[model samples]
Target: MLRYVIDVVEMLDTPKTSGASLAEFLRSQGAENAEIMVKTIEGEEGLSTDFVRVFIPGSRGKSSGGSAPTLGIIGRLGGAGARPERIGFVSDGDGCAAALSAAAKLLNMSAQGDVLPGDVIITTHVTGWAPTEPHDPVPFMGSPVDMETMNDFEVEAEMDAIVSIDTTKGNRTINHRGIAISPTVKSGYILRPSEDLVSVTETVTGVNAVVFPLATQDITPYGNDLHHVNSILQPAVATDAPVVGVAITTAVPVAGCATGASHATDIELASRFAIETAKYFGAGQISFYDADQFAHLVSLYGEATHLQTLGRTK
Candidate 1:
């Protein structure tokens, strides 16, 4: 499985690449339903990139009158291949690499007769030359498209729950080797961390689950001069579904676009964790958040969905 991830990283780390190559790679691995769409965005340094989406239908299949929920596993990254300044895949691409790895693993598993109960849809964009931005502690990777553009394509209606994975090494908050999970966010409300996911993480890694400390501002929309821990929680602003971040962390602060910084072992751990989560989550063995409790909170506090939008003034 790790070899699959390495293969993906090497393939995506090229200068002239698109989602077509990724789609082909996954197809070669038996992902027959994979699709690719490239949109020309003016902001991506004039680079037209591709958005790749791979659907591994459950045993019942979504359109086949199946009752199982669909899980959206999004690989959040500034770019897969940061070119020119950075010659190959950057540290920020860990999320995309891990997501693709999980997709490949799941497809292989299904081919080998280990199918999940619900569908798993993985989405992410590929760009070779993404811009960079300056930050306080370290330089960060900038996307060719804005956050709004990313949210528009990554967040979809069919996803009952979402796991947004990003490279979180530029901050000093988390100091771990493998990865950390964030508190579940739904419709702008941050709920108690899901113990079920923690147990799943522990079971997968054989170690205690590490949760990244999150604040109210963390789940809000990006920009507005407000500081974000990272883009890990950005998907929460675009959907009412429960969203959790799977952060690829490090022991110290590392710039997002830094080359020669990706650790394959750490990425493998994150990919395996995602695979485990997908397996149990689709089987109804995991709960992202209690819907009844969230409804009760909504009733008590009114609509916090306003957090999902940019602030407006009269």
Candidate 2:
């Protein structure tokens, strides 16, 4: 619901906020099982900020020997805003908002005795101010920390699959409202769209789901002097699990650091989609890809997981 989106935005729009207090806020919302931790790593750019980890252990609890698969919902963003230059929360923060809102909804559902079958871990940082970087189409939000640090904090081994949500407004390739789902990415190959995810999208939106195309460079590690479609695929490089991008798109390209660009309704739609996906994933009703098929592909063409790393030095 839009109320959830608005609630998260109001909480994180403070002058100097951190994940510690934000975690407390979620606790007050009945996410008593949620865990929060902050990580800070300095990059060469001399910019540093806290990267937050919020883990909401499901009813079966992965650590408790739950057979159900664990689903990781990562809020991918550069920063919420750029401080004085960009006063309020920017478009990039949509991922953080959507992830939190979905967590809140799930927790509320659990409170009502409809807990998910598997574990759901939600992670993202709450940086009120972040740096901006220049790109080909438009300026992008530069992370306060580095990409390696982010992946280290966000991607966990317990996660069997990942839904990397990011604001993809800075591209003209996808000119639509609401959100779009990228094809499933596992190991290193960009495989066909996951039929399960596509069905979930259609059932939720009541419209044929849109797929945003991905280039090879898009899935590569950041800071390689290569252009990325967006950071939606960044998590793929850090995990062996299958990763899919949940894009918050618009009809026209929008800068990630642009202020006054966040739309609550659009965010609500994306959040709901994430929540639904988590539900199915935890229930084992959906699979990122058929394990048998993926293994066959690997046998035919060899391993593509190396693409998930920095690759061999020349």
Candidate 3:
């Protein structure tokens, strides 16, 4: 596993901009496969501002092969000029999220042969909050843990191609503002009109059967009037639908609840719901994605394979 930390000096720089520079620098350092971390210097200026660190596993080889490599990229921003209370630099959350996702794709490609052109990569953000309780030994000394729950801030994924989720004139409430971004990005390759996000289904031919049942967590309520109200199970029933391959997008945890709850707790609940649902539905494989982490899946019954036959004709 490789862990790298980098500092970005430019005040108004975006993740994409900084990522490109870091990626190029890695290439120059004879790093065939590297995980980099970017961070800005806390109280440094110009020359000492932008910095990057790279982590490589095992002995350094001329070729970028032979072992599984992991990489991390971190960046920090600085505050205004010489102000005591001025906000210093911090890492771009969105950029970090996207970079992590890209790294995941690279890892997948390296581990498993070539990924299909239209394979879907899902990314999600979950956040939760709860009141902090006092550290007291006595039973009534500490404050009561009033509310604790998580929320799905966003769910994004990219497929080989995008399909429209129409919400033209119907109830605008169904509009999946968060879920729709991934499909739109993918739609460029496949000519499809954008629509309101609803659901997605894929049929794998090689697989014997597939099923997805609601998990216990999904049925349970988290906070007051807050819960996962809807769920869409792909391939509702196990069908011999030419099981060529299977891919299930992972759910993500959101960040920051309205009332400052525990983000970890919310993510745990969502993940539990996903795990139970996947198991109940007989999913041969499962994957995970988060803001800090990217797209990654664990195959329960088979190898991590790609669907090469999609959009192909005999």
Candidate 4:
């Protein structure tokens, strides 16, 4: 059995959804004995609010009762304009789907806390991969390479929520760019240098938006990439945290490959790696963002700042 901790932050005004509701949602889905707590302060500088704490049990198989894990939730309310700009929740499970389910439910409930119509909901998941074996080089032939499934997990968010995710997994080599000509194309040929480009790209074609981390360093230092980047983004992506994207400029690379050394000759030494970077950088918490909503936030804040400056001058 795995343990999970969930933290919920309320960013909007009005009686938004509470952590208790989210816990209840999970319970309805066959989750057992979710613990809940609420923190409220009156006449606070911000709006009056409540913080709910909840704990949820991990998914294994249903059993009668054996000290099931508890879910915790905390809610806080402040002044009208004091609503939290973002809310977050974290859950752990045996596989990805279980973790994702908890996160998706929390975000969906939070987004609809006030139960307002037309409220936008978005969701996405980021996957991290650690190479368990050395990289194997294969000739660029039109042949299908068998991939051993290291780990497979899924997180289900609201059906309508838009998802933007970044996956941290081992890299694959493909023969598409260019090839050199020689008397014996297979034996005497020059191989072009492979570029290590890591950036957020589209995944899942057209389901909201998905970001693929494809830069070399993003997967470099083996353990570093996985530990730092994925660790930070995991909760946010899994729980549908509100933000644009994580700023990973100052993150350092770590040592260790997912796959071992000397396993495959074709695989590059620095080709695939995963590592843990840091706990927190900015705001002390990693931020997750929906592609469209984040853009709207930027525009709204930009205009608000301009108006405030103009009013001061007038």
| TM values, all candidates | 0.95, 0.95, 0.21, 0.21
lDDT of 3 by residue, 1-314 (tens): 11221221231123223433644544444434444554433221221123333333323221234222111121111111111211322211222222232333333343444322112222221101112211121111100121110011111111111111110111122222122212111110111112211112211112222222223222222222322212111111111111111111113322111112112222222222222222222222222112121112122233212211122233
Report how far off residue 309 is in candidate 1 (Å).
0.9
Q: Candidate 3: how many backbone clashes?
A: 48
Candidate 4: segments with Cα more than 4 A from true spot? 1-16, 57-101, 104-314
Q: Comparing 1 and 3 by TM-score, which wins?
A: 1
Give the local distance difference test score of model 1: 0.84
C-alpha lDDT score of every prediction, in listed order:
0.84, 0.84, 0.22, 0.21
Candidate 3 residue runs with Cα over 4 Å from true position: 1-37, 41-102, 115-178, 182-314
Off by over 4 Å in 2: 39-47
Backbone clash pairs for candidate 2 read 169-254
Assess candidate 4 and give its TM-score to the true structure: 0.21
Ranking by lDDT: 2, 1, 3, 4
- Of candidates 4 and 3, the better by lDDT: 3
Q: Which has the better lDDT: candidate 1, or candidate 3? A: 1
What is the lDDT for 224 in model 3? Answer: 25
Native-to-model Cα distance after best TM-score fit, residue 200 in candidate 1, in Å: 1.2
